[model samples]
Target: MFQSFTPLNDKVRLCQGCDLPIRVQQELPYGKNAYCPRCGTQLSRGGSPSLSGNLALAITCLLLFIPAFIFPFISIHLLGVTFSATVPEGAWNLMSHGFPLLSLLVLFCSVIAPIVLCAALVVCHLALHKHWFTGMKLGTTIIYRLKPWAMIDVFLVSVAVACFKLKDYSDIIVGPALYALIVLQLLSVLLISRVSLRRYWEAWRPEHTFEHQSKERHCIYCHLSQPVGTHCQRCHQPLHHRKPRSLERTLAYLLAASLAIFPANLIPISILITNGQRLEDTIYSGVISLFNSQMPGIAIIIFVASILVPMAKILGLGYLLVCAHWRKERFQRQRMKIYFVVKVIGKWSMLDLFVISIMLTLVDRGQILDFVPGIGAIAFGLVVFLTLLATESLDSRLLWDNHPNSPTSGRSINER
Candidate 1:
């Protein structure tokens, strides 16, 4: 049975400031702070302005969320006839076109997910506003659940693709909803950056007091707080204040993702035929053709989603991992930064996947021009999937080893 620590122990080995248990021992030269093993309550800590900033941004985002959904995202003009799509309209269009799967995908990615995410943020803000620190556990869980499903960025990529592909046939106009969507995305990022969970935990620990007693402090992992301990049962390490393997694993995943990217992009993604003429298009070629056909805006989008964004994800993850591995990085504060970047950018790589799905459904005009996904589509999908996995595998805690007062639990290194 799993057990968490409590203040009930008679011989309390309290955290220096908070009077909570020293969950684990600290290594020398770092002077790590001890924490309550169960609740992760810090013994002593200082407040940060970031918490207030995060709350403000979260509230602002909630206000923007309404307009983002209520307005039309894009308008299409075909030979003096005009059609516009709200997020839901786009879904209906796909469904009416006999692409039910793609329709649902669009609806969920563009509409449902964004709404849920914003709502979760609002709830979190309210909880924080009410000073209900205990409620934050639930709010954080909701936010984490919403993270993967919030696909506004991915939807933006799809819209850009659609704009490019449709440009040759019609006039495309951006709408209020599109700008709202952009603002919503920006606000979400700001909210994520402004909050630091660790710092929050430190500041809002449950009010409790424990009297310090003189007994040997036991390690949470090894069950032995004896001086000069050897290994921990949790992490199974000669205990150090920092995670040893986090940097290496992060770097390895980053490098692997970088290596796989070349093949993913260089390959041909689709073959398009117009007027009974066959034309092979790589990802770049397809975007070029879109621009040559007077869809520069769409071309820019394609380049961003299919090429630049994914590369940025790989490079950013790589840089963070390398920095963490060197021990030169300040892990605690920066850990959230790395985590936010990875979580937010992970789904954007699905842009190519969305493009493939859309093209497969929309370009089947029987006798005029036919489009079929090529090898590049499959490869690109795999790369995106793998990179997402790599991002998930990275441990954000690796960045905090240098913190002067980190917790001592063997489990601390493992905590997200």
Candidate 2:
């Protein structure tokens, strides 16, 4: 029911996805969506955040967050013995068993990072509502940085895989923490979706006095517009229209990740030693084993998480780089869409590492059933990390830019 925002500064909006700058369109009174013309990405949903409403969800998220770790996550009964684990216990178990680095990775990505994300959203939303403008900017930047790394969703998937893997051998019982995690993850997703960043940008929108658009350098990370070569006023980061060295860094990471993939696949990732019988698994062989065990659901998930995601990320990034380097302007939306998907789903390849962590904690039966990390697991982890870096560095806007006939070509980017 809100009218179109008309700022006194005549602020120009840049598409975060495709980088095409455009005027804001008024939403249809019927509540139809407003979208970027160049890329058809959603600009707004014809409404703003209900500060109190979302703040309550944020509070609820924080409330549920602890229960997700405090209660038992899963209980396993095998061979007349019972084992159980809580959320924090899993990572600490890893640390106690000689995987200190992995302990940190899991603890940070799964627990601390997500908690900080929820808290940051709370601060940002509260700051916006209270007219605490600078804190809002700072909190928004923190959310953006932590957004990808706060991987509760990935950890949840790992939990599911662990359950599937052990179900055949153990009587798997779901715990209250699992339910709590589900609700917490769901709430976090909803809270993020409910955020209207357009509102925040408008709150921080500058009354630009620059005579020309080229003189307006915008920091892509925080969307702060400023004079060229100076630090951002709000985020204090460097200002640039295009991401710095987007292509060069992407290529470097892509090549390094590709080199690691060979050893990652050729070597065994993990070994299962049960009752003196040894079974080794490469990434593909693990998938095959899952399939052979009649656990096709788990098999498909592992295949997608471990194999398809990395390939999609690497190949999709490679294609984007090639298209950008060649200045191929055809299908700009499709390329940008591919880039968007890669940026999101690519990081989930870390699900494999998460699964490793959970298994290492949950499946140690001492001579009966012990899980050992192989050298290949290390290499595979490198591939996941490197490809994630590559995809993140590959700016999607490059897919739309540098084109001879593109709308952005020969235009003053700083102009309103």
Query: Who wins the TM-score comparison?
Result: 2
| Ten-residue region with minimum lDDT total, candidate 1 | 206-215
Candidate 1 residues 1-416, lDDT tens each?
Answer: 11224443332343321222343322212334444443343432232355657666776776776777677777766546556666665456556645565456656666676566656655655665686754655555566555565676676768777666766655787889889888888877666544444344334431123232332233332222222235532223355333346556656666777776776778777777777788888878888887888777777877887787778778777766666567553333444555566666678767765665545444444635466666666557656655666676565544443434434432431122
Q: Which whole-number lDDT from 0 to 100 does residue 276 have in model 1?
A: 79
For each candidate, what is the lDDT?
Answer: 0.57, 0.74
- For candidate 2, write residues 342-408 as lDDT tens digits: 8779768888888887777677658387787767877787888789789778777777666444544
Q: TM-score per candidate, in order?
A: 0.53, 0.86
Displacement of the residue 149 alpha carbon in candidate 2, Å: 1.8
Candidate 2 global lDDT: 0.74
Candidate 2 lDDT score at position 136: 80
